[model samples]
Target: MVRQILPISALLLGSALLLFAGGMNVLILPMRGTFEGFSAASLGLLGSGWAVGYVLGCVFMARLVARVGHIRSFSVMAAFAAIAVLLSLLILTPWAWVPLRALSGFCFAGAAMIVESWLGERAEPQSRGRIFGIYTMVNLAASTAGQLVLTLGDTTGIVFFVLPAIFYCLALVPTAISSSASPRPLARVSLDLRALWRNSPVAVFAVFCIGISNGAFGTLSAVYANEVGLHLTAVALFASLPVLAGALSQVPIGLVSDRMDRRLVLVLVAVLALVADLAFIFLRPDGRLENLVMASVFGAAIYAMYPIIIAHANDHAAEGSAIQVSGGLLMVFGLGSIAGPMAAGYSMAAFGQTGLFVTSAVAHVLIILFGAIRMSMRAPVHEAEKAAFVTVPQGRMATPETHVLAASPEEAEEIIAAEEDRLAEEGTGPAHEAAAAATAAVAAATERPPRVSEEEP
Candidate 1:
């Protein structure tokens, strides 16, 4: 394992530094904006702006990498991020920060993708899972540490902004100085909504709804923490703990999801999230401990939903197309992420801090209702048919490269063809029709010949 990781260590180091800066950059703005007397709506737009840039990056960053090469692209993104952070400090206004935040988002996405591309290239098939696991752990720890670092500094001054800028520059050092060769061009993602919906309505709907709920909380929770009069330490914990809890919760959730109908697990999780949302709205946890505990529960359910939804989608997806399916769902999630913050911001502006939970509750409720309806419509993909649930990091942090880390192309292709054939023998339904359409669409888009044998594996 040590030898396996040595080759990509610098790439991982770069990723860790990038995430640390990203984590701090994300937390600092809202906390500082609150102090700067920015409106809840404006802060919300900041989140929206980031999502917009992120979505754009997901679409276009590959082209940039293709044009400039990964090293140059990574360098450019890091420089842009550093500049964005510095400009935020200089201007100190919501309008300026919004665009700057967007720039930061675009840069962060590009940089992350580049590093992931490198990791993907270097990883051996046998050790890919271990590499991905370590990479995820490093990033999560770095990001958490970055967010918590704020407790040591004054948000009122330029220090917090400078810190992220410094870290952003630091992110460049490992990648820039590393001896590893650049990987192939980044994967291109096309979001075919009709096909995605046809593939699995439940996966599509749940992922989008999860995006809305998670986006709302992710952007506003810190602001919410501040409004509720929590101290800075509590506020930092409020933002970071849910992510930590969510990471830890994926183990049990993955085990359960792999065994039963993933839709059933999704419904259960959504209900739990809804319960947490209601608790926040009704009980209105004022104390730090009360809020912290609730956030952890809320995080566990919301964070775990994405991977389950992805796995569920893949279970229904045609062979050799899991990457495309995951990418499409991620794009759909990004679309929801862009809208979530804006809507949540308006709600918070109108309804106070509790509005955050109100927005989240509505999203989770929709997920539950829609998931149940889909459950009634389609038969569950049998336990043997299910794709293994790989743990994914939370929203926006996931990229196409991340999917490569989760499951190899060959592994994903082989997992379900046999079961799919069995299902076909049993009889065809809407699910079969949808899968066939999706398969055809993927074949056309990729310009690859469709696999002839359902039992090829």
Candidate 2:
């Protein structure tokens, strides 16, 4: 047990530290851009760069892992991420920062994949639930810690950029000296758009819209807070508060989703998002405590949709094809993320800062229209189960929980039966096999004649 757990623990620590740095960088970027005299439009471009690179990295980093092996890939990527942050600190030019941000995105994706792959490898079936829980908690804490770090340091100085680098380096320490074996080759997920769309058109379409809407919010919310005369610390808190709320809200939202029609739940979420967007657009709350509450509630709804969409898609997915379905949806979401900031940023620049919410509201309007239309057209994909927000780390280890399932129920049943047969052939029952064997040995001893050798007789 110790042997299995030790490596997993190390990987978890590394992942948490990296997430901390990632969270810090995310929060600091808007303030950094504003200070560097970049226009809101340019800031949006910076976000676009990051999202584009992130999507590409997710698609191709598995190939990089296959080429270099896990440890080397991790080390090299970590170094690159640190270097990218340092470059941003030194140049302080928006144009330079764009490419640097993209590099950071790429490195972040690669490193996360490494850590998640490791977790996947080390996890056991019985322990997956607990492991996933611990992973989510650590991620939440790490991300929150990073956002709070901005309060301790002034964003006015170049020094703030170095902190993420320092934390990124710190992330490397736990994995560098650990004695865990390298994870096996990563399973590459191919995008099958036709199959995905056929399985659940609403899920495929909604993910794209959700990605665009949320990406715009994520990229510009800090800038919007700044425009409204929020203090730097307040801006940080406001930006982060929503994310935390969204994380918390997932539980109830997921539960509600499991019990009812997923599309109905989706429509409800879209309506809530629509209302939130309109609130941001029309109410334009001046830095009051009430505005903070509004932001939290609004954020909770928008951010929570992605996972629900994923779960809903999985519901309709051919039983064994969940990974491909999920992966295809993620890729669609990634594409939307790439487009979101660019469009919203330009709108904000042209129409003024409120355009951020305007853009978001418009997207949600489209989502609502499409969702309402789909309500009449499509049927439920599968029987809904209780919604649970079980987060598993994307570790390098091959944990049973994180693996792709077979695409059909027949395939699943066949695999289960085969496993049972194999165990029977090996003369082992599930769980307590050793104890059973010991008891059987005592009975055999009692039945056997007194020990006697023919030669001795």
Which candidate number would show the highest TM-score if scored against the true structure? Answer: 1
Backbone clash count for every predicted candidate, in the order shown: 0, 23
lDDT of each structure?
0.84, 0.70
* Residue-wise C-alpha lDDT for candidate 2, range 77-176, written one tens digit per residue: 8889899988888887888988988888788877877776666545554455555566677777888788778888788887668888988998888878
Question: Model 2: what TM-score?
Answer: 0.84
Give, for candidate 1, the lowest lDDT window spanning 10 residues. 411-420
Question: Could you tell me which 10 consecutive residues in candidate 2 have the lowest summed lDDT?
Answer: 392-401
Candidate 2 global CA lDDT score: 0.70
